[model samples]
Target: ELFYPKNKQHWREWLFNNHHRKDAVWLVFYKKQSDRKTISWSDAVDEALCFGWIDSKVESIDKESYKQYFCQRKPNSTWSKINKEKIEKLISTNQMTKAGFKAVERAKQNGSWTILDQVEALILPEDLKQALAGYKNALEYFDGLSKSNKKMLLYWIISAKRQETRQKRINELAELAGKGQKPKQFR
Candidate 1:
């Protein structure tokens, strides 16, 4: 069976109606028109994770775009720190459940909880900046990136787990930018 929401915010109300039965196939759509007024993808994901749900995958239905096919979390799936913080906020506000708590405990026991250890804020790290300073043309191209593109690059960098990993990413990003390349979605 399937249920769909006009946007992510409405999904919260629907979750209430369903009482989070633990096994329902929910297809959440991201109608472009939804941008007219909605809570946004980030909020939606946080709310979903708070309730022990995770995004499975999305499928585009048409030109305007329609997202599909999400389901509740299974026992084995791990959690992200970002989502864990969201759940913690939910718990503080009396929004958590035994099921949700159980999931958190499982994550803790399996080391998934700490594995998500605090992510640094999304900002352009010095490494990328250093790389760009070395190449005038690349700096020009990097400066030409739209706000969204630059923000996405910063986000991708901050999500890196280790210094070596981030250095590698910086190298790749600099090489691409040096040749007038930006992140795929940047263009």
Candidate 2:
């Protein structure tokens, strides 16, 4: 569904009504409209977070507006550091709903809440660094990667639940890097 909320209150009302029933909504935001004001993306996200929803998959609709997908937080979704901090503030301010608190508890129980810090530094692991050394092209390609891509690759490597899986990801990344290819999703 597509919704264009005039302001944060409108967005909050929509979430109040549909946070449980709807699987997702495409929230439309005005980019440069002079006569019509709309909720900014950051504001929209803050409201959504209060209701245990998350934003993803933004798409430009026209010069004046765009749509962002918002949906209920998945059971195993990894939380970002920024979002974690936002939730903390939300809790302190008494803005978080029962559903939102439940989602946070789930993340805490499953250990995804703390994993964001592991990826924040974006450092290459010793195993991957050594592997990349044997492939000069791969090392160069990794060096040339954008900071986000590098962080993502590092996260993929370090987030593995097992040492074997982590080693496997390191090998896969090195092999892909050697071929002058980025991970499929990044490309």
Candidate 3:
């Protein structure tokens, strides 16, 4: 269901009450068409993560507002550096719920908890970088892509669960980029 919280307190209350419910999906509204103030996305995310939820897809509802989808964090969901940092802060503040701690434990156990650095520090894996650099067409194409596109490509490679799979994906990505085509997942 969709939820519109005026501020962090309301969001916290909602998450505290609903975070344990597996069937719940929340679409949190932010911004407003009129003068009414609303909780900022950052604050909402803070509360959500404290309850072991993650923000997913977001959609615009009007000129002045949008809704962000939030769901329980799955066992293997990859963590973004930004979200990881926020979780750390929430932990230190003693805001993490039992469910939140369990999610962290699951991520740690599965080896995805610390896989990515902040976006600005993120680069394509060495093997992927070398492959691209060796192919002039791919190198040119990659250099021309927007920052988000480049990040998406690198992220896809990084998220691979095995070394062989990562290498295979890097090769495919290099070949696709060389041909001026987007990865199927990215496309």
Candidate 4:
């Protein structure tokens, strides 16, 4: 794992040092608030993703105003439209490091970075809602899903590689949910 500096001021220097590294590594950072003086997960994630890095599982060090952050560039990680937009902004602001630049270029060549998909969980777009609406039983069941169960459905729907595939999943989930079934693994 790699560790970025604690402040935004240290980003450039730290990035330069790790710019040439070929493999992904974690960068640790901290955020503090006026009230608690702590950094946020979103901030760390946004910054790390800009440099082609991803935020890994987190751990608590103590009850202090700080926590350890695990940040790394995942070569095979999928890109989300939201994160893709953030990376573009980082580039325009001259915040992207060379390794990050190469990663983006590679994604471009591979057609993974640019192709936007509904790759998030727990967000039900109108299309999916309409699809599920056709089945009243499923709709009722879907409405009764717990947050985690709903999120599983969302992840499945969003990760569908094809339109037909997603439709099929929606149907299946609806049928299962109609029977008051929670996502099997989730339940």
What RMSD does each model have against the real structure?
6.6, 3.1, 3.2, 5.2
Model 1 stretches with alpha carbons more than 4 Å out: 6-10, 16-24, 34-39, 118-187
Off by over 4 Å in 3: 30-33, 118-120, 133-147, 160-168, 176-187
Q: How many residue pairs clash in each candidate?
A: 0, 0, 0, 11
The TM-scores, one per candidate, come to 0.50, 0.80, 0.78, 0.62
Writing each residue's lDDT as its tens digit, candidate 1 over 1-187 gives: 4555556657777665554664655454556564534345666665566566666676676655556455677664656656767887888888666656777788778766654232233245577889877765787787787765775676566557798888877777787888899756555
lDDT of 2 by residue, 67-163 (tens): 9999999977889988988998888999888878888999899887777675676667789999887775999999898888888888888678799
RMSD of 4: 5.2
* Candidate 3 local lDDT, 22-113, one digit each (tens): 54565556454567668888888888888888888888887777788888888888888788899889999999888888888999998768
* Model 4, runs deviating above 4 Å: 1-4, 22-43, 65-71, 109-111, 114-116, 119-136, 143-151, 157-172
Please rank every candidate by lDDT, starting with the best: 2, 3, 1, 4
User: Candidate 4 at 64: error in angstroms?
Assistant: 1.0
Off by over 4 Å in 2: 125-146, 158-166, 175-187
lDDT of every predicted structure (CA atoms):
0.65, 0.87, 0.81, 0.61
Model 2 residue 114 CA deviation (Å) reads 2.1
In model 3, residue pairs whose N, Cα or C atoms come closer than 3 Å (at least 3 residues apart or on different chains), thus clashing, are: none
lDDT (Cα, 0-100) at 7 in candidate 2: 95
